[model samples]
Target: MDKRNQSTVTEFLLLGFGDLHNFKILVFTLFMTVHIMALTSNVLVIVLVGVTQSLHSPMYFFLSQLSLCEIVFTSNIVPTMLWLILVGHGKVSVAQCLYQFYFLGAPVIAQCLLLAAMSFDRHVAICRPLHYVTIMTFTNQLQMVTSCWFVGFTLTFFIYIFLRKLRFCDLNTINHFFCDVAPLLRLSCSSTTSVELTTAMVSFLVILSPFIFIVATYISIIHTILKIPSTSGRHKAFSTCSSHLIIVCTYYGTLSSIYIVPPRDNSINMNKGLSVLYTLVTPLFNPLIYCLRNQDIRNAVYKYIQSFRRRKVVL
Candidate 1:
């Protein structure tokens, strides 16, 4: 089949985390637990936020969207991984591989914009309290979310389209656990100029743009936090933002290290290991960070669990 006209790739073989002498099964079980915990925790946060009227604020709204993205992100990668690990088969067609790439990457890019937007929301809420409602209005927030989705999927779709034009006659075996750009590019037989350039452009725009904005917002936030007169007041405000900051830093730092930094070639396993943190670990933490650190969510979860037990006892 001609490269430009090619529509099918017979099959793809994913070389997962790596060959463990006898520990691959353990790794599989570990990820299975993560999937369950991630799903349950994020769902609970969504439930708590949706049902509780008090939780209907810009911060929580951003959290809600973050939870949604984390859920979609985890769902995209984990089920396929589980199927592969359990069945000892990670074979995928070109279509399936591309689909997985789109589904996974779009949310990830969207999430970057979403987090930057959330930082802005926090900045306004904390630093410009009087105008918070006016600045972060329902319409404005919706527009932001929509913009994130647009930017995210647009990059993902373009990358896929560009890659589709190239021929992969050299190597068919994927080195990483997931369909990452660099690893996949290693397999191409045609000129990688377009793919590499496009990927670099997209990555620079997506990662760097949001990162700069987020850092600016946080700098302003810290300045404002320092200006507070009362220690208690500062503590309370910092407490609210601290968990979000932790989650944000963990996500972005590891992701930047993985994609932006040049792969050492020898430490490809380190790259895959870091990928697991973003893909598997973040989903598990998103809900816990929001709920455990948030009183409204904690209260709602407590009530929901109690009510369920009561109903069960009555039955």
Candidate 2:
């Protein structure tokens, strides 16, 4: 790895998805729609959780936090992507690129923590109904949320510093949409030893570790669900776990494909598709997953709508 050519390389060319003029507007519209839908749904979740006091329990408290993270996550990437597509500046400053990578990476890693904690919260609620209140106290819940942020942001920020030192000598085009760690690292002309190592460390700690925990916890949950003598009780337990399971599968599955595997020439399309899964699709699904089977959320949504209607009529 020679620093001569790399150090001279300043900005990155984000070769965005493809070089096709035909579907440009349609593709932009679709991505924008996802961004808007995600924001709208996540915002609705926040408001619903706030206004519906019954949802103020530890589970929904964590949910509210998840929604907040989602907002931060999508805003980091989608707006920039929209701007680039609209204004035609595909190359971003190195500093700006690193910063975007940090923010984007932080939320994704943080989501794993939040998701795992939520699973634990659910486990306690279902398995240990009697001691759930004492164990998952407000303080404990707060601690969990704090831990999620601390680990997420700290891991990504440190990694960002290593990534910033790399000199991009190759094609500056950042393949895919937002600045991802893999594609960015591939362009580095300098030794990527530290950058790659730090990335792997964060991936293991933030992504893989929590994914395993969530899976194990869900296994226990499934056993419990199966043990219920009454079919209705079993069904109810499965119902509660359904949304979380789907989200876990979607978020972790796509994310793991990107970070866990080495970059392959054949898998570029797969990476692009998976990036869309976690970035655009997951956020949109979280709100719906939360309220879909939840009677309380559904009721609150209706109540909120009805109140809005009454206010409009009065106005």
Candidate 3:
């Protein structure tokens, strides 16, 4: 730890999937396709929610926010990943790496809070139908969304501050595709105990707390659904929040595997694989699941397509 022995690392070399040299082209094509599809789907969701009057409920509002997060989340990391795959390894300045971490981390934390807020929205709609309108006012929705973004960025800023304090020595190779905290910490010659501890505490608050809230909210939702006297009523109630539930499961399942679970001796590759699930696959599937399962989204999409077709015919 002596200053005399330390060499400043101005840039980092990301060793992104370089071992897969045989599948370089395949990996590049796959990542590019997923990135484009995730972006397109999230954008479509945002557009449909914005333009379609019938889709302007509190639920759809949160869905639009979630899509926006997905767009930011995937775009921040995937392009760099694609470049790394193509080049075998990519060089990035220390500042650029920290910026990447902030952008990527903020949206992830935002999405966690957003999902929790969405669960609360579903809870109000289902458990207190009569008060749903009064409870989920436009002002309230804005407050919830604002709080999510505010807390997300604020929490990540602290982590960024901690990261900036740690000095990297001569070793500047990041084993992962992106500037993830784990990889950067691995390369740092300075002590990372404080950074690791702060990250752990923040993860517990952002990830685990929201997940626990979502679970408790769903339990209440299910209890209310089961009490419905008519079978059709129960089915209808379940359908309303089912899409969000699916997304919650998929998002949290992959996320917990990577962050919550302890890493094993050969867990780097496994972590990368799990990272793909949450970062790439989850975003790609979110809008698809919602559109397929939610009647309102489908109707809005169908109506838009019909309108487009009619305009084409007129032209």
Candidate 4:
């Protein structure tokens, strides 16, 4: 790979499930259905939170932000993958690839922070019920959500800045579904030691730290719940935080598997499968898990439906 040959590279091929080309139609249909379901469910949560005044608490506020992040996060990558599947063309320009990875990484980090925010809200509510309102005021919630978005963008910007300087040379084919940092780094002909180290530290800050905080919060929550004298009281306490726990576990479980575990030669397919689970399947199920488990959300949805029905009858 000489300098002359390296200078000609301007595009990269995304080898998205190339082995599954025989099942392209099936894969396209499956991903399309998942994308629609994810969008509808997340948007429904947002709309419900906005209209249902009773649901306007610090927890629901963070939940709505999480939904918004999921919508943007999935939108950044899924559509392009679906289109490429349909067209059988995986070519993406250097600029397009970089932007895609940048946007996707931002939302991914935002979601991690949003989840941490949600856990902190739960901790305040469960551990310090008397001061929960004072601690988690509307202004504080707004600032926390805004900070998450800001940090998300800032961290990813540095990542993309380093990535942009890497020389791709002639090895421009990305062996994954999207322009993820790992795949892109793999394709870079230049040394990625600094970029890799930076990414690792960012991952710890964005993903690992939040995850640890959430765990600590839940541990305190559990300790608090155990002190309650009555069985029904403990049940009631657990019920409220259960949905958040489910979502947190589902998200971090798959995500940790990807980042924590070392990649290997034989596990590329396995890694892609895990990516699909986290990126595609997790977002689709998040709203459903929350809505189904939450009685308040269910009641709000029911009331909304009844109001719509009454209007239809009047018209």
Q: What's the TM-score of every candidate structure?
A: 0.93, 0.93, 0.97, 0.96
lDDT of 2 at 27: 74
Q: What's the best-to-worst order under lDDT?
A: 3, 4, 2, 1
lDDT string, candidate 3, 1-315, tens digits: 578988899999988886676898888888889889999999999999998899888999999999999999998998898888888888999999999999998999999999999999999988998999899999999999999999999999999999999989999988788898888888888899999999999999999999999999999999999999999999999998889899999988888898789888799888888887777899999999999998998899899899999999999
Residues 29-72 of candidate 1: C-alpha lDDT, one tens digit per residue? 99999889998888777777788888887788778888888888
Candidate with best TM-score = 3
In model 2, which range of ten residues has the least summed lDDT?
A: 1-10
> Distance (Å) between predicted and true CA of 145, model 4?
0.5
Judging by lDDT against the true structure, name the best candidate.
3
Considering summed lDDT, which 10 consecutive residues are worst modelled in model 3? 15-24
Name the lDDT of candidate 3: 0.92
Give the C-alpha miss distance for residue 200 in model 1, angstroms: 1.3
Off by over 4 Å in 2: 1-7, 87-89
lDDT of 4 by residue, 55-86 (tens): 99988999999999998888888888787777
Candidate 2 clashing pairs?
Answer: 13-172, 13-173, 13-174, 14-174
What are the per-residue Cα lDDT tens digits for candidate 2 across 207-276? Answer: 8888889888888888887889999988888887787788888877777778887778888878877877
Candidate 1 RMSD to the real structure? 2.7
Best to worst by TM-score, what's the order?
3, 4, 2, 1
Clash pairs (backbone) in predicted model 1 = none
